[model samples]
Target: MSETTAEKIPVTVLTGYLGAGKTTLLNRILSENHGKKYAVIVNEFGEIGIDNDLIIGADEEVFEMNNGCICCTVRGDLVRILDGLMKRKGKFDAIIVETTGLADPAPVAQTFFVDEDVQNNARLDAVVTVADAKWLSDRLKDAPEAKNQIAFADVIVLNKTDLVTPPELAEVEGRIRAINPYAKLHRTQRCQVALSDVLERGAFDLDRILELEPEFLAADEHDHDHEHCHDENCTHEHHHHDHDHHHDHDHGHGHGMKHYHDEDMQSLSLHSDKPLDPNKFMPWLQQLVATEGQKILRSKGILAFSGDDDRYVFQGVHMMLEGDHQRAWKEGEPRQSRLVFIGRELPEQTIRDGFERCIAA
Candidate 1:
């Protein structure tokens, strides 16, 4: 019999570019009596403080005790805060993590899977990305975070739709579709979508996930090893970045306060020691392309091709994906499949699962 793991509770991560209406949507979710309790987490009270009046004035029940909604100064504080929330398991039915406009989401997600304390308590539900329809395309032209936010989302919300003309809306939607094909897109104005529509959508599932990826099944057959999977107190912190620090570092284009303005191309590398099936994995890839393709500066990876000794190499632009053989697993060489995603703070897990769906259970 194959070894199976226990199911973990899900928490949603909400992200978007600066002034993209994330707080408005969050306020709406907090007010909705959707029959589920939500514990809100964010960078700081002051960051989203501007929208407090709107959030508090909304009809939903408001609870702002001294430290209930998890907020932190540094990115590293997320794990400890999430651990605190898990202790009160019955107090809230779910958790909602809101990232600052300047924030990157990769490190936030790494906390869930990499940290023992966090992984033991909470599971990632889904990544919901909000976009300012009126200004997103212009922002992505020079902002890497904007693209990353879109590429990583399981659900994409095109907020401020009313501000854009029909042609502008169509152009932005087309751009979003090219970058991420798998994420569900929500069109709204002033974050006016139903809270139930975004939060209660039931986007993540473990059992159903097995049915989605075939590559994992085969990869599971082989003994795999990874440096980050150990039980020791995880100290490695995944930093959410807005630019490709590789060649652009010397140019000093995306550092400090300017980080939010860096429009350079970015990429992320995803690796798994496990083999995966192609059938289940295709949806995530398609979703990525359809939702955030235009913002995608670049993407490429080696996937385990089913029934063939050769590995598959997939490359794509905004909504366009092309793949062919890269190389075959060599004797004594690592057979692990790895994919590098270079776009703005694209959620690694969503992209990880895109290929993860290919894993055969």
Candidate 2:
């Protein structure tokens, strides 16, 4: 089954806040001589490639661009548009969904994993986020969707380098790094990044994540900046510690940069040197997400089971989880398990206690 992946088309999700150069980067992709065919799905008409064009389907808002790429407006639902595109699949090499600037990427990404028909025909390649370096800092403070976009990104294009000073640029990058250190970061002007960097990144593919390792931020001792959101998902009756206070635990960053701690949204990383009992671990994880998935925006694990030679990996979006045995552990490699959860007001103690119980006795 090594060649099983080739049968599906790769879908790259483009996301960011308003005026983040998503359209510019997208136009670059459409105009570049990559010698590949693309079927683009935009949220509304006249947002992308609206120049002297041909109307292939008026009611459907599907048309052909001057560059020979097929473009369509997302009139009603995304699944319907994808279903229509699937019929003409062979004509294109890949699918790129440029979500509206105000859109949340979770539902868009969830389509590839939750729908069996979409899953069979397409595989998620990556979530590419275009950020306006000049204003990302401000958005990070005001917008929940902005933070989620940064946390969920696999590739981040920090564009408009020409707009700010060196100090301003570093602060913006630091803010982005605080949320997600794993995404590939590229600083560009006018969204002039190499095409190879964004397309076909395979960020969600199991093979691409073969060695799943993450860098984490720890609780900082000095910062005082904090903000909280009383999300309904965070207000659960957990039989544990005080849930009334803000969960603002800031991690120290470089150069005396103020560590901006998001009270409502944050990431937690758990690790175990000891092998986990699969019977116990699997059920605990499923139950954890089943009850808390609405709060959990994303979850992933690279596990080393107690009695198995092969490693297991899983990726989740809300309530959906997909996992499989990846490959045998190398002779000299350390056998350990690492799990990460990024979400809003997660039940840390419940998750920690449950994870601790999964360790093999």
Clashes of each: 55, 1
* Quality of model 2 by C-alpha lDDT: 0.71
lDDT of 2 by residue, 1-361 (tens): 1334446888888899999999899888888889987777766567567442221222222222233212211223556666777787678888888877777777777767656677778888889999999999999999888888988887889999899987688678767755664567788999999988899887777764653242221221213212122333321222111112333332222334444456667666677779999999999998887788778877878899999999898888777688999899999997878787877788888898899999999
Query: What TM-score number comes out for model 2?
Result: 0.79
Each model's TM-score, in the order given?
A: 0.54, 0.79
Please give the distance, in angstroms, between residue 52's alpha carbon in candidate 1 and its true position after superposition. Answer: 12
Whole-model lDDT per candidate: 0.57, 0.71
Candidate 1 versus truth, CA RMSD in Å, comes to 16.0
Task: Determine which window of 10 residues in candidate 1 has minimal summed lDDT.
Answer: 218-227
Candidate 1 lDDT over 82-101, as tens digits, reads: 66665666777777888777
In terms of lDDT, the best-performing candidate is 2
Off by over 4 Å in 1: 1-7, 46-75, 200-206, 210-361
lDDT of candidate 2 at residue 293, scale 0 to 100: 79
